[model samples]
Target: MSDTPPILVVDDQEKLLRLVVMLMNRIGFPEVEGVTSGPEALERLRERRYALVISDLEMEPMDGIALLREIRADDDLMNTPFILTEASFDFEDINVAHQAGADAFILKPFDMAVLKTKLKQVLNSKPRKREAPVAAESSLSNDFPMLGKF
Candidate 1:
């Protein structure tokens, strides 16, 4: 891994993904990557080490909740800071995301300043200890069923 912290942005919307990438760059994250689906996000995770993961809660095949669960279960990514974003601020949605292991939840139509603040907080938090690799293997069974529809 490079000295600069890597950030991963995951969303089904291509435009939003690009926008987040641009924003992170502007906000001073030197290394950033964006992906459009949960599977693609996992692929990226396996290939690199990221300091933070910002994902959208809703999507076609796999949602952010499912992605968060997978990340939490993986020993390598268990402590990775994950921020879940949603257009709606439904309490139930927030609760679900929390249960799935999201480090923070941000409502959509968000202000860049707020996002920057949250990013800084998460990035500044104590780093998690690296765990032994758990094979770096993912199976369909581990993925949410709804993801297949997409």
Candidate 2:
């Protein structure tokens, strides 16, 4: 990762995306890229590797929850740090995000300090070895096909 690893920020709002990119750059993450939708983000994810992915929880077509689930399902992207940002905080949303392997969750109207802190926490996190669950409750495949076992 060159100096700072590249970050991919996904948000439907163009202004928010721009602002996030600016803030990330100012905070020493110069190699930041923004996408307007989950599909677009997935395309980019296929093309390159990113140190982190910060996505808005609400978006057209595929929302952050769907995106996060897909990311978690893929073995290659499963360990990548994912941060979900939303304007409103919901406990159900938080639970799902955490279960989906999200590293951090941030609120909208981004806080530079909080963002920085979360970035550190996520980056410093050790890689988790992908191990199959021994218990039935550990598998989320029964509900979410994307999160199913191989």
Candidate 3:
């Protein structure tokens, strides 16, 4: 962990991504990176470690749920905190995000204060332990069967 607080913001919407980056910067998280897709997010994760990953739930190619699943599957990245955001907080979506190993959930169109508070909470929380390989494999293979097909 470097002294700088690095964060990854993953969202397909360019406007949202820029807004998040700006907000995070204003909140003292200067070292932030943004990506427009799950694959790009994963690539960024591979290249460097981030204190937290804030992702939008709905996206083209790989959605946030599938991205969360993939992140949890990788031992090196599994323990990293993931904050999922969606425009709506339907029970099914929340449950699926939790099941996929999301550390926190944020609703879209959120106030900057709410996002800042949640980010602080997650960053202050204890580091997570990597899930067992068997569990990770199951999570990746079972939860979103429709993932790769898209």
Name the top TM-score candidate: 2
Give the true-structure RMSD of model 3: 7.5
Global fold similarity of model 2 (TM-score): 0.84
Which residue pairs come into collision in candidate 3? none
lDDT of each: 0.76, 0.82, 0.82
Model 2: per-residue Cα lDDT over 29-117, one tens digit each: 98999999999998898888899999999899999989988888888887778989998767677657767777777877878888898
- Report the C-alpha lDDT of model 1 over 82-125, residue by residue, as the tens digit: 98888875657755665565666676766888788777776776
Worst 10 residues of 1 by lDDT: 136-145
How does residue 76 of candidate 3 score in lDDT? 94
Off by over 4 Å in 1: 127-150
Residue 125 displacement in candidate 1 (angstroms): 2.8
Candidate 3 lDDT by residue in tens digits, 1-150: 349658999999999999989888888887899999999999999999888999999999999999999998898998888999888767678657867787777777878887887787778877666544335435443433323321
Candidate closer to the true structure by lDDT (higher is better), 1 or 2: 2
Task: Supply the TM-score for candidate 1.
Answer: 0.80
TM-score of each: 0.80, 0.84, 0.83
